[model samples]
Target chain A: MTDAVKISNRNFSVFYGAIQALRGITLDVLAHQILGIIGPAGSGKTALLRSMNRLNDLNPNCRVEGQILLDGEDIYQPEFDAVRLRKRVGMVFALPVPLPLSLFDNIVYGPRLSGIRARARLNELVERSLQAAFLWDEVKDRLQTSALRLSGGQQQRLCLARVLAMEPEVILLDEPCSGLDPISTSRIEEALMALKSKYTIVLVTNNTKQAARVADTTAFLLQGELVEVGPTDRIFTAPKDQRTNDYVSGRFG
Target chain B: MRIPPRNTQALAVTLLAGATGLTLAVLVFVIVFILGKGLPVISLGFLFDNPQEMGKAGGIFPTLVGTLILPLVAILIALPAGVGTAVYLSEYTGDNLATRIIRFGTDCLAGIPSIIFGLFGFIFFVTTLKMGWCILSGALTLAIMVLPTIIRTAEEAIRAVPAGYREVSCSLGATRWETVLKVVLPNALPGIVTGIMLSIGRCIGETAAVIFTAGASLRLPHSVFDSTRTMAVHFYILAREGISNENAYGTAAVLILSVLLVNSLSYWMMNRFIARRTK
Candidate 1:
């Protein structure tokens, strides 16, 4: 994993209407490594991930009070176009949300939105993205088939492929395998491991063991506050914070 | 004196079944009553030949043409505006006072009587505009009458599109308009079409508004500016004037059949479109 800081959150906070979801979170996600955010329910993990790409801006009640920098530039600046930023920073939601379209159409939605209308170019993207997400072989022959027909795990991976098609520099996953079988989860983990060399990945998950297994760096959040973020090995084995230690040791979520 | 759970369940089931049966019976009875009295009067000659002697002796060819042109023109005028309003209200305008007022306005418009709309069309399009009871005046009136139906149904349809689809589209860098156009609208198509179908039915059956504006001219309409007689108006004049009960029934049958044809055709097209996506 590279030691370069791809993203830096400098005392960021988020509010949904009147409720504070994240409170002064500061962290760095290094390039070419999976940064796993492990937290229990309502710990602001999703809020943090979504805010990076300004997906949270859709909510009329959403408000933010901090800066998240991408490659030394603050993304929250008024001049920073959220639409263009989303193209660079793709996201995979917690549940698989395959659009009611063919597999080919779903993968090319981002590309089409970005004005890549060449037929050959879209076809190439469909193949390569599905391959990168480890879904090409299973669905290679049925690209025109409806995406909703795919199994839950395959659908989630297809969602990942949809992001890949955008050729994004950063890939954010919010509990990508929260509802997957062990084999499916392992397959996703394997794909992520293989993908990190070319993409900066941030994985938000409830499973601590998943973080321990795949993440090079791990951050634990407790009730909307970041307890600590460190190397996964150190965070899991020798954390300096007593709360982190207790949480890692399964004392309580 | 609390009833036992099993007995209550059975009683509830019986009552629900009886209510359903009664509803179905009423619907069937109305359809049968109309078709039974109307079917014997229909003939190919009656359909193709132009009316003679104030709709006493020939076919309703002119009225059929009017029926086709009037609804077509009205739908063309209202569909874009209604759908635009629906999309803007649902996707662009957040929950605010303006949106609420617009929604309430649509509801009020929907609640207004067809006779009232006829009066407005007569006063506004026919008299004030000096359009003189032509197809344009009638169609404009019908368009206003159907706008609320199309807007309300299209809004419901657009809102029914899963919130997740919008999120996915936005996250993939789609602009609000792009998301609405590509994702939300296509998924909402079946519902929008259903709303359109309902509007078409209302336009085909509407007598009050069309009579007030279009002026029951038995002559075939040459253009939007030409005053014409629609199927409903022809039927009303025939039955009311006691011109020919036989011809009136024939027009009624033709009206029923055309509405059915349009409805089934739209449904078939919609089903095929939906099937293609699923496959």
Candidate 2:
């Protein structure tokens, strides 16, 4: 994993309308390291991922406070273009949602948005991205087909390829393999393992085993607060906090 | 429990008998009578060609064109605006007083009478705007009349798109506008199309609103600025004026057939588009 300062959220609090979703969350995602944020429902795991790119800003009642820095630059600073930030900090969702376009279009949507043209260039990018996501052989022949027609597992990989094609330095994945079968889950884990070499990976997942299998570091969150964060081995085998121990031991979420 | 098996059977029979005798009979009778008295005089030429062969009282060609052209124009104006408004309400616009007020206004407009819409259309489109008694005036009136339905239905459809989809889009670093355009709109296309079809159907059938704004003329409209007649208006004029009873029947049949054709085509097109998308 490459070492560089990437995304760091400092004392960030988020509210949905009058309800507080995240409370004073502070975290640092190192460059090229897979950071796993694990928590039960409503622990603000997903909210943290969204806040990185200011996706929560779409909600009129949603309000955020404190600093979120990307490469030591304040992302919330007005001069920083949110649109451009999103293009550089791409994401994959829990359920596969390839935009209702052809598979080829789905893979190249981000690059095209960033003004990448030339059929040869796009074709190369598509092939590389699909290969990176381990989805090329299954979908290469039918890239022209609608992305919606693919099986759920294939759709998820297609979404991964889509994000990869943008060539973003940071990749945010929110429970990327939650809905897949065992083989599909293993494929995604393999892809994420390969991806961490080049991209800074921040993953939010409920699967403790999956987190241990792929993450360099693991954070345990409960009730919208980060309880503990450390190396995956330390967090799982020897958690410093009691809550993290209970969580990792399956005693309580 | 078995004290009155015969009585229970008798009660069921009586209840179903009353429903079949009263409710079903009225519905069947209404449809049969309307179609029975309205079908014989309808012909191909009466439907497709402009109503120019027999003065203002014979053919309904101009009216047919007017009915199709104006509503289609109105739909062209309303589809994007209505769907955009719905997207704003469902996806972008927050729960604010302005959004609430717009929703309330739309609801009120939906309940307003078409005659009142005609009066408003006359004063606004015809006099205040001085658009004259043209098809543009008529189409503007119809668009305003149908806007509420389109907004309400489209809003519901947009709202029905699963939150998971929106979350997925946002998480993918799609800006709010991109998410709404690339994800929400495509997912909600079927429902939005249904709303448009409903509005089109209403616009085609409406006469009271078009009557005051769209002057009763038998000539084909070369532009939206030209006054024109519609099939519904022709049906009314033929039925009321002492022209010929057959003309009225033929006009009504033509109106129904045109509406059917529009509805069928919309259904086919939208279904095909959705099927292709899913494929």
Candidate 3:
């Protein structure tokens, strides 16, 4: 992985109403690498991931303190347009949502909304994005078919492909494989490994083993606090925190 | 007294089926009775030719034209405002005091009687605004009457769109307007169209409100400012004025058929929308 920091969260915190979900987090995400966040329920993994893209802005009660920077520039600056920022940072939700449209239209939705109206360019984007998500061969025969008809696994990959079509600089995934079966999970992991060479990825997962299998650097969070973070191999085999050790060894979650 | 579970199940099914059957039977009976009394008077001449002598002879053509024009005008005026209000209420505003007040106001408007609306229209549009007993005055009244329906339905439709869809759209860098236009509007189209269709039906069948605002003139309306009589108003006059019972039935028959046509189209569209969404 490159030493260059793609994102930095300095003394970052998140609160919803009276509850604090993330507290004073300071972390660096290296460029062109997968940073996996593993935690049990109520550990604030999703909140931290959403904070990267400012999707938390959608919640009325959500409040943020401190600063988060992308490429050494503070994202929370007054002039930063959330819409434009989203173009640079795409997100995939846990459950697959295919927009109830034709597979072709679903993939092209982002580009079309962004004003890429040329039919040929849109077609090229659909093909390229689907191939990158490893969904091209399966769905190439029926591009115009309704995306809702696809199987669960296919729909999830289509969602991934839809994000890919945006050509975003960073990809934030929140428990993307939590609902998938073993085979589908493996496919997603493979796609993520292949994609990390091009896009900075932050993944939040409940399955710690999945993180160990794929993440270059893994952070273990507990009750909205970052207990430990290190290279995935060391974090798994020889973690610095007892909680991380206990969690990784499957003694307690 | 405890009843056997199987017997209770059977009794509940019978009661529910009987309720449904009774409602359908009443509807069929009313439709059949009207058709039986009126179909003989309905000929092409009766439909196409202008009435002679206060609708006692000739045909009901001008009233038919009025019925068509009034609703068309009302829909053209009301659809954009209604849907716009609904989008603003559901998407832009959260559940708060302003939205609650707006919703309560809408519900109150919906519950007001048609004749009360007629008095309000006569006072506001006809006299106060000086629109002068014309199609425009009448259409404005109908537009106000149906605004609640259209707003309520459109809001429900927009709200029914999966929240996840909005999240996805925003994540892809779409502006709020872009998300609403491309994602929310398309998904909500069938419901919005259904609401408009139902509103048109209400407009077509409106008699009390139109009579007060749009004077029952037999002359064919050349413009929005011209006074005209709708099918429902014509039916009321012909029946009440004792002009010609035959002509009155004919007008009632035509009005019923047109209302049925619009309603069924809306129902069909709604069913298709539901099916597609579920699929």
Error of 2 at A142 (Å): 2.6
lDDT of 3 by residue, B10-129 (tens): 999999999999999999999999888888899999999999989999999999999999999999889999999999998888899989999999999999998998999999999999
Tens digit of per-residue lDDT, candidate 1, span A1-253: 4899999999999999889999999999999999999988899999999998999999989999989999999999999999999999999999999999999999999999999999999999999999999999999999999999999999999999999999999999999999999998998999999999999999999899999999999999988899999999999999999989998898888
Residue A189, model 3: lDDT of 94
**Candidate 1 positional error at A228, Å:** 0.7
Ranking by TM-score: 1, 3, 2
| Candidates 1 onward: DockQ, in order | 0.88, 0.41, 0.60
TM for every model, in the order presented, reads 0.98, 0.89, 0.97
Native contacts conserved, per model:
0.94, 0.41, 0.59
Instruction: State the lDDT of candidate 2 residue by residue for B1-279, as single tens digits.
Output: 475888989999999999889998897787676668778766676566666434343457777788889898888887778877888887766778999999999999999999999999999999999998998898889888999999999999888888877765655556678778877888888888889888998998888999899888888889999999888888787678756667777777767777778889988998898777656
State the displacement of the C-alpha of residue A248, model 3, in Å, after optimal TM-score superposition.
1.0
TM-score of chain B of each: 0.96, 0.88, 0.94
Q: For model 1, what is the error of residue A15's alpha carbon versus the real structure, in angstroms, after optimal superposition?
A: 0.7
Q: Better model by DockQ, 1 or 3?
A: 1
Candidates 1 and 2, the one with greater TM-score = 1
DockQ rank, highest first?
Answer: 1, 3, 2
Higher-DockQ candidate of 2 and 3: 3
